[model samples]
Target: MNHAIDSITDGTTYRTGNPEATWRHMRAHAPVHWHEPGLFPGFWSLTRYDEVKAVLRDAETFSSASGILLRPLAQGEDPGSDRTLALSAPARHSALRGAIAQWFAPRNLRLLGEHLDGVAKAVVGDALAAGHVDFVTDVAAGLPVEVVCAFLDIPVADRPDIVAWTTDAFCAGSAEERSLAHLQILDYFGELAEERRARPGDDLVSVLARVRFQGALLPMEDVVLNCDNLLVGGTENVRLAMSGGMLALLEHPAQWAALREDFAHTAPTAVDEILRWTSSATHVMRRATRDVVLGGRQVRAGDRVVCWLASANRDAAHFPDPDTFDVRRTPNRHLALGAGPHYCVGTQLAKLEITAVLREFFTQVGEVAPAGTPERLESIVVNGLRSLPLHLTPRTG
Candidate 1:
């Protein structure tokens, strides 16, 4: 089939700079529309918050069985994979969710808090010293990778390689490039897994190697897939979330000032608000298992649905003023971390990260404002600032 590809419809190509205007246009006219980009079959872009929630919450009707990205990921998945857990629906997703759930709980990461604090302090301090710095690099992007490193017990110094592999593997700009990055990452992981087997360490990988589920320790391939999931789901998205939170603060000075005044209670709310405002990850893809009606539109059994968290977060029907960046926005049930069985595993870690970064930021710098308008992440799956330049006014001592 010659897909009706309006190549320019891709948000990554042109929407990288100003997503709001693009989303606004999407909501206004083509809210549940499709546009092929020659790479894959087009999909329905669900624009309203209720509509997205309807899909995510009701996984049976709108399933992730087809996977999330625009194009089909190569079927090179190692047989014993937690990705089987992640990409499967119903029974498989439930089992996978239960297996990984306790691993990322607050109680599980209790021993990790102190090291995380130190990491946040180091990055925030570096940014402060630079006088002016890219928040994405100095703080946001830097912190999560370290935290993931902490979780995996990888050396802090290995961040460049870890971040790079993930960037290439998951953040590649196109289907063909992503396909290539996938093979490379899987190869790198194969080596890493072999090394961990020979010389084990005190990290998630070692623990995962030992952890049992459904009568036995998971297969080595599952171990690798889980690590890949942690690599993809944990690092950059949280970095972008924190960066987006900072950008929200920069754009809404009142919210920023409020958070500065009361760091304890206010910082957490700011995290939720940022999720509401930014939607760092723009969309998650799902396949329709059966025919259904969403927002009054009939969806065929095999249809692909792109749940636009970007559009959903700003749906006026759900959020009052829908467009305002209100840090204290209450009843904020945004789809930032998604919902149901596949909700993010690193939620607590992410919250702690945003809180820690904001604490160090407000305490040390006093004032932080954007040096330029936000630039979006150049991928459809994740939304973030490619470079968030911020000028932090020094605290009067």
Candidate 2:
């Protein structure tokens, strides 16, 4: 355990570079090992596939409310802990969860998807017309912002700021930078809330404001939380899914070519394999409510536990030749969306967006290759390519 802690603190990007081999060593030798970092409080790093599922399933023992990610925000920083309801206790998490659940329900999402497809088609059309472009910005990044904006009923002019808020809020930002961005977003949402009150629209927030969840109409903070959820969870995950999926395809062009040739069939499986491959959002943290044993170590009440989704996705115990970028791999039970109540609420929407990008790109353009070396995102939580300089050839139709 002491040795394991040293490696994690030293710095390791499990998804990029050589961390895959390093993770294999850890999983085989120490599936559940306590880790400490200089910049952050140490947590238990769960590497094995099964162990991660166990922690995810039994939320009572290993609570999401405990913590969602690391940093405990470094030394001498202002206080930061598990404050978001999404990462809080069951009762508190449930209240916000219940209100948003209806908004993301299958029927509701189905209605959302209808609008989503139109947006997807439009974006794809624009990308194809450009002939040569940076696929991430021209296509992937724009897709979710449009969908999330439509869902929140935010005007098109302000959609870019919504994406900017998430970049500043959820991922990493300076104390001053994060604080300022939070205030700006809150002010924006507050105005929108007022607009909805005076003239309710068909948007989710307007409906949510009128909703009586638990006892009565959900409060402003809860509404804001859901708004924040829509703002963050709504677009970013799908954006990562599209960007990461494109990266995976670039890395494995044989599969990418295969997908391009017959997108109607390979596109769906490509989405699954893409999500499994990316496992963006890396991991979610939980606190040990009581003394418990995992991977042969004892964890006490105050200890933070980290799930290595990035590692688990490539776990040899679960994924065969886990490093291979094979889209056709069957029985891929990778925990990309996670398990239990905390599973991504936007899974369906992500799939649609991903599929649309792939099918449309393949159908409209070809000769896709790296224009320059792609840059990796610096975030510990939101793993992705910052700029994927992909060059595409005009399609001959």
Candidate 3:
């Protein structure tokens, strides 16, 4: 599946055998190349580290309000129709972000340590009980959804449906199917929002329901959209990161041994390395607010700029031996979670989830080996495994 460097069809899949080569080629020859119209529309591709950061940091110049995906809006859609932080004006985005910031702040996330520990124990315990499992669904996807449910105070019975809705919304599906899933999400969250309004709890929904934005409660649309964002972000990113992280460790036995040796000292750096090495967020799009010169290429107003975060994380200029998977790597400031204004809001939560799960996994499970071929999700946005069959070997005294 070696795609042409100039083909718009290249965007169909995250990689083509060796994606690094494709990125390297673009970084060297076409750092700010134009990807002609295809499934979506023509856009500029930024492959270098500095170039990607430049666009992300200069949000005023390259806006997200228009939308982040390269695809044009469906009929009757406005610039801020979504109203999520990823698709809202700075002022609106600030209010929404501030409302949820307290819940995800490091201090607040620490309070969930015991709860996360229990979730991790159960996830790994089930795998241990089974002896073999689909690590993607069984192990990687557990803690993320559980943590979200805990925050939203969603009941255990309802968690599975929410997870299914989010998974279908993001993973492989037809546009109509995806739209129906999204609508179902909005309907479910909308009903929950009303419930919170009636009897306010300490969860996110209640906060959003009561919290004043611009001296008034947040509109139902914004609340639903942002909640949708949180659910999708909460479930998808860390789930993929964990699945990808495990795959990375399995592929690199030395790194796995290092993680198993001293998780406390090594987990932090290893997690950062995992985020960098398995850059699950392949790319994000930004629309140029006005004419701007980027990496020697001229970007006009309303022009789409595709920042390849995955490529930037592997840029040779910033990272030495960028392709190698080294868990001990330091000063690893990767753009995997993004940077500046539109940087992922669920970052701290993700860090906590990844660290806890990885620590517990290494501590409980003795060794992991591939039982069958892992199937990658066929998505341009999501770099994740749909199924990862693994044979587990538990620790024995």
Clashes of each: 1, 2, 0
Candidates by TM-score, descending order? 3, 2, 1
* Highest lDDT model number: 3
Candidate 1 C-alpha lDDT tens digits along 1-397: 1121232235555344555666666666666666543355757777767777878888888777657656533443234322445576686666666655676887877877887788788888888888788777667877787777767777656667776666656445676876776666567666666677768776676665655666676677767776777776787778788887777776677877888887787777778888777677777878898888876677888888888787788888778898788777787888888887677778888888888888787778877666877666666667777677888776778
Task: Give lDDT per model, in order.
Answer: 0.72, 0.72, 0.82
For model 2, state the Cα shift of residue 364 in Å: 1.2
lDDT of 1 at 290: 88
Best by TM-score: 3
The sequence of per-residue lDDT tens digits that candidate 3 reaches over residues 2-83 is 2456442344445335567778888888889886665557789888999899889987898888777655434324434437
Summarize candidate 2's per-residue lDDT along 1-397 as a digit string, tens digits. 4554344433334334555566778888888876654457767889888889888888788887645666544433222233344665777666656655676677877777667677777787776666655665667777777777878888888988876765565433365787687778878887787678678888877866666645776566556656766667666777777888888877776987788777787777778899988877777778888899987799998788888887888987788998888888878888988877677777777787788767667766757767777666656666676566767675776
lDDT of 2: 0.72
Score every model by TM-score.
0.84, 0.87, 0.93
Native-to-model Cα distance after best TM-score fit, residue 267 in candidate 3, in Å: 0.7
Q: What RMSD does each model have against the real structure?
A: 4.0, 3.3, 2.4
* lDDT (Cα) of model 1: 0.72
